[model samples]
Target: MTVKMTRLRNGIVIVLLIEFVLALLGYIFISSKTSLVLATYIFIKNIIMLALIFYASSLINENNISVSEVLNDEAKNAFIFGGLGLIKYDKNRNISWTSDLFTEMKINIVGKKLLEWQPLLASLFEDDDIKVVDINSRKFEVYNSKESRMLYLKDVSDYIEISKEFEDQQICVAYITVDNYDESIEQADEQTAASIQSTSRQVILDWAKDNGVVLKRYKSDGYIAVFNERTYRKQVEDKFKILDIFKEQAEQLGQVMTLSIGIGRGSNILRELDELAFSALSLAYSRGGDQATVKSNDEPIRYFGGNSESYEKSNMIRARVIAQTLAGIIKKSDNVLIMGHKQSDFDSFGASIAMYAMCKAYGKKTYIIIDYDSLEEKTKTVATNLCDDERYRGVFISPLRAQELNMSNTLLVIVDNHKPSLAIDSNILDIVSNKVVIDHHRRGEEFVELPLLTYLEPAASSTVELIVELFEYQKEEICVTEREATIMYTGMLIDTNYFRTRVGTRTFQAAAKLKELQANVGEAYKYLEDDYDTTLTKLSITQTAYRYGEGILIAFGKLDKIYSRTLLAKAGNELLGISGVKAVFIVGKTGKEEISISARSTRDINVQLIMEKLGGGGHFSMAACQLEMEDVTRAINLLEEAVNMYLDERKSE
Candidate 1:
């Protein structure tokens, strides 16, 4: 209610009380006749006063004018006693009557529109107390009176500043570890190893000092750092430059060094912070290291500094341990079911068959799950050849048949892909209690949550190479059949682009072992040969290729015929063979609703990262993704945009 209306109502009540008191005094002191006359006069006065109050209320309601304005200073004392400040505003929200307190505060509100006070109003609405500066600055508890169109503010800045300071002092914890420390030191002489370790420690300490973080080395290769919320935000804003600094220092020592950093923040409990840090650390390592990962109590994982190539670790000992473990798992199970990603390629099919052969050697019944409808031509050809042989009858089964045969003791092994959504039969994974994942792709956001065992090596050329290593370490003497050797050889051949890209010492070793087993290279080549029509189609597609960004080529068009993934990959690889082309991206439709992209690079660009942005992943040099987009042009545009964005980011780095 307006101050004027409230005061008018109080005045009417006071007048009535005064009338009653006078009537009582007259009746007690005067004669009967004179008292009656005084009473009649009092009744008439009361009626007139009530009529005047009602008329005044109607006028105030119609004009929105406070009674204090109509009778200025009549209720000023009441307003002061109630600790209320009143200011009248015209229809334009221009101030008219400004209180003395506002004037004393040097708040020149009169004759100014309400819009001019938005800054003060915004601050007032955003917090319990707001700082206002006219000629002098102070904080206030703000209140708004809509009926009177007035603002009231009471000072309260000191308390807010103290609360903000306390919030800024919250603690955050981080853990850092030198990835590949063992391999780096083992390859160097004792003196050089000592130098590397010393340099690494000094670099970390210097970084901590520069960032105002308290550091403590808890292990030879691990350190824990504590930071305040303010410093943590600064670190995040800088994108954790310490990771890049460590990489540079390690390279200076003639060693490849990478750090995996995990940070925990936004939690009051130390135990929760520790758990978050551990989770972040695991995520950083799983994404191939050389990065800083942060996980607050409620936020998803955030990453930085993963631009460098992943270092290949020596996995001889680890491979041996895994081989022994897998053998044990296989022996315990009644039957083994092996499958790979949907639309199985050479790498996926070869890895499955290799596992099948290994399980058979242990005298365990094994089934190779094959979805024939989705199989590529080369994979189908291989499957047919293996089925015709007398030794491999009844080895192949459909997804439905596999489900029926699935038992609690059965072991499920996934190869060439780790994402459950991309599995040939994702349902089987849910039904089986025992599951193992083996893939060579860099870990993505979508992956199997918990597997009995995981053999993920992003540095390896292909999943088949890892399987070949396992074969060498298996306790039982297993003979590699010619078919088995050929398929494995073919897998290596395709994934490495005929050993021209992503070829490492271990990759060559796996190939040499396969050759030693008399794997027929000519047969593998025969399966990869394209028909005349396919060759022409690839050539036509190649003609559509155009330079995109720096050293990047993009070939985009709809296919004249539905070409298999093998042919598309060949097209991309052929584009990379052109001089001055560092990378090639081929985008086209293989089916009505499926658009496939085959990315190839020549050690200059990381195509895997590009494909990963588009929901696919593979080796740094070779990667591919399939989108549900039906428009070939739209898919091409998205691919080009992704490639350009990657190139720009690298340039900035």
Candidate 2:
């Protein structure tokens, strides 16, 4: 006999036995109520009922017919009636009893709880609305009753499969581009050039064919592909291994060749999907490329693989163009206000001051918005000096005052940061109609929307470098006070970590311009010197840090005391230079209700992506994040998990 026949035979025997026991119990109860003498016959009555049921079962077993010959799949053709099965359990979810329909359905519920055999049913027991689940290759609609401690399961596989079929056929669009094709191809020889061109094409074509995507190449470096939702889901399940394919191929080519892939789905409109794909691709480039960014209709954009730092652009044309546009916006606005990230450091403060002078050169009323209460000890000195200067009196204002000023045609120039949430006063952004962003950090998903001009150069050492270049293209000449030039030079010094970090040709050129303006190097260095207490904190971090696997170090400060963001960042930077430590993550309490992390890495690691996973972003070498947790130990646990997860993903590739 087949397995189904055995199951059917067992189920029949069990059901007949249950019925026989129940009937004997009813007969025994009636006899006991009649007379004491009849109670003695109760045991005999039960044996007779059992014997009768066994004889009937044996007669059925003697027949030659099997269950397959007796019934169709699901026993649908054999049964004239079908009923929903009822199950009851305690609050602990242990199985107490099940109705007869469960036996007919071939479910092995004997001596088992809901979760023991039906782990998927664990969540459905929450007493929520009716939910659908799959059990034994059949779909079920589950309805729960907490008051009665009962659950109702009805098979609905036919309707569920129809809905699933429709869902799997939804359209998905992907836009792909060779990230460094223009630059890489210009330098390659014939053999290598052919590999970058045709080999790159074959890599994508093969993957697309494997994934059931219709591939079309529109440009030498660009392509468009289409696939269904089922295929797209499988790609996500595999963590978008196309990124790993590109990484392996680039290794063989011995050059910087990578791809940016943007996929858009969850919508039927083809035009909307195309637009989304394009937008996602642009975002991927802004975030330093070498990745796949998937954007769904109403969902957050998901990122995969950005293990490499963005390559620097060699041209200054884009910088000059942005400078001209910025100058025009400055000339048109009635009044301009400059702001930076919270607790503005020398880089942020210097960029804002330079912008202040640039706007002032346009002969427009401009003020640098700052909050004195939040200023660092070093920035307070810079602010005090500017106030004492004859040229800068009444030039600096608070964010509150900037917002209260006449609101018409006002220009907002945010420096050193693009994300509004990171601003000193995010609310100030809402009142200003025209805005400009000057930043050197890699772009993240959050951005200042529809700015009048955005000058973002992640490759540049500092925002001040971009500002100094803009000075060459401006229509008006900006005169430098020795104090202003010193601030600008200090911004460059701080961001580049005193010229130890990445420094390029334009970085030096910008530094040369500052030197010519009589920016005293001695004065710039004075602002970077930390107090004795801060020095102690920075030293403690490295001493306390413990090594994590794969050249990562983890450290945290006392939970009872609050540490400055600058302190944590400086500690991370210093720890990164130590031998055998490729990346350093320093965690500490920044506020009574908040914990913060400062992550720094060498060229071998990408700390920015790690921080982004923890709700923060910055350059590949440096980044930070703030969490709402008060316990430093708990925060360290989360950081370890993120590091392990990132490392594990790379290992898998």
Candidate 3:
């Protein structure tokens, strides 16, 4: 039992003993022969004395009251001995009574002022303790009696300070890595490499010194930083300026550089700290690097420093390994089902068809999953031509049929997109245990989890480029037919905008290999040709374009009938031809209910950030988003708002 309860029990026992003794004395003093009047007088006197003793014992048992002040200043003694301050407030929160401690503290609380303090008091009630700054700063354990309009506070300042000091002394571990270090330094001369490495190391060292952090360079391209909670918080608030500094210095040296930073905190166990730091670093790299990711023991992960573009790693050796792995997985499956994102476009169809051809060569049954009802015009035309061929008949099926044919060994290969929500049918993911993902877009939060094999290269122009690389590394002789070659080349053509943007050396090499397989560029051009009505639509959309935010152009177009996404993208490209335009955004509706925006920019701006804010993602120069709104004007307004916010943030930085 508690101390107060034990004292109350002892007091009750003492009171009972006194009462028993008094009753015994009354019985002894008044005999059976005594008169009724004498016995009644004795009984009354004993009862009065017993009541006085019980009251004195109750005073001694009271937790907040003292025995010495039973008759002298009960309230004053309670406050002094218990080390508590009492404040009573009326309905309006005006102080009705203040104890001696409350008065000495000189708290200037008025009617509404007490309401201002309610949040702190409520937090204390919920947490059992809170820190407050009044006439003097102190930590308190609070007890509140709402019915009596009273509050009690007990001092705990010393204990709170000691706990805080221990927390501030705990160490946080951080791992820093320079992304694509080998690719960046391999081509440089010895002196140039040394200079770049020195500058990068100096920047990190200077930042660590400024923030009171300990740094050690244990590897040529990596560092380990140790700091306390205060320094970590300051680095988070500053958005890890070392990222921007390193990028700036590398650019001056005629090289592109990016850093991935991972911080592990809120754990005292050394093994767990190491694991958290490694997890954070992996997340940063998976998100395309050039960012800082923090993981704490009890909190959700936090992100920063992703405003810049990610440097691409053109690792052919990694690609070859991935290709071989994919072949092995495909051979082991019972059947293969190739799928892509919603509203299938040329890139999606091309990658699916290429996979189909490879599976056919391996003598494995395969089907391409597409939503025929939602195909764009050009993609629909290509699908029609492939279906007309007798050899390619029944190769294309809908998501429903694919599910019906799904088995335990069925392999699902997702191409051109990684987000589960953007899948043709997200339910397919649950049915298939063996899965593979291949895409060229920058990674986002929504991605497939735990695939058998994943080949994602944001540097490639299109998924077709990656697939072509796979075909090159295949061990057996594989003949990519003329039609398959044409389809794959067309996908590359569309994504690279007729070889005008996002084309790398590998992109050209893939195109050359496709030509060697007799891919007809002339036929591909014919497939991309626009009719008279579509040409007039593009002209009208371009005419509606207006300049926004220092040479960024925005256009709003409404279609009487649902048009192809390719046409919408073509309209956006038209606006970029203007001499002064640095970026272009085109908003339109694909059907009765769906609204979409296509974003494009030059090297001066980053359009991916703007689209990501609207719940979509892509490369730095090209991105798109589909919204639920029906009104075209509202979509345009939201687009402008995102653009302005992005520009304003850049300016502030």
**Candidate 2 residues 380-458, lDDT tens each?**
7888878988888888888888878997988999999999998888888887868899998888888987888878777
TM-score of each: 0.79, 0.81, 0.82
- Model 2 clashing-pair count: 0
Which one wins on TM-score?
Answer: 3
Per-residue alpha-carbon lDDT of candidate 3 for residues 465-510, written as tens digits (9 for 90 to 100): 8888888877766767898889889999988888877788899999
lDDT of 1 by residue, 404-448 (tens): 984869999999998888899999888888998988887777877
Q: How many clashes in each candidate?
A: 1, 0, 0
What is the full ranking by TM-score, best candidate first?
A: 3, 2, 1
Off by over 4 Å in 1: 1-168, 559-563
Better of 1 and 2 by TM-score: 2
* CA error at residue 395 for candidate 2, angstroms: 1.1
**Against the unseen true structure, what C-alpha lDDT does each candidate score?**
0.82, 0.82, 0.79
Runs in model 3 with CA error above 4 Å?
A: 1-86, 93-102, 110-146, 150-171, 216-218, 265-273, 296-301, 559-564, 591-593
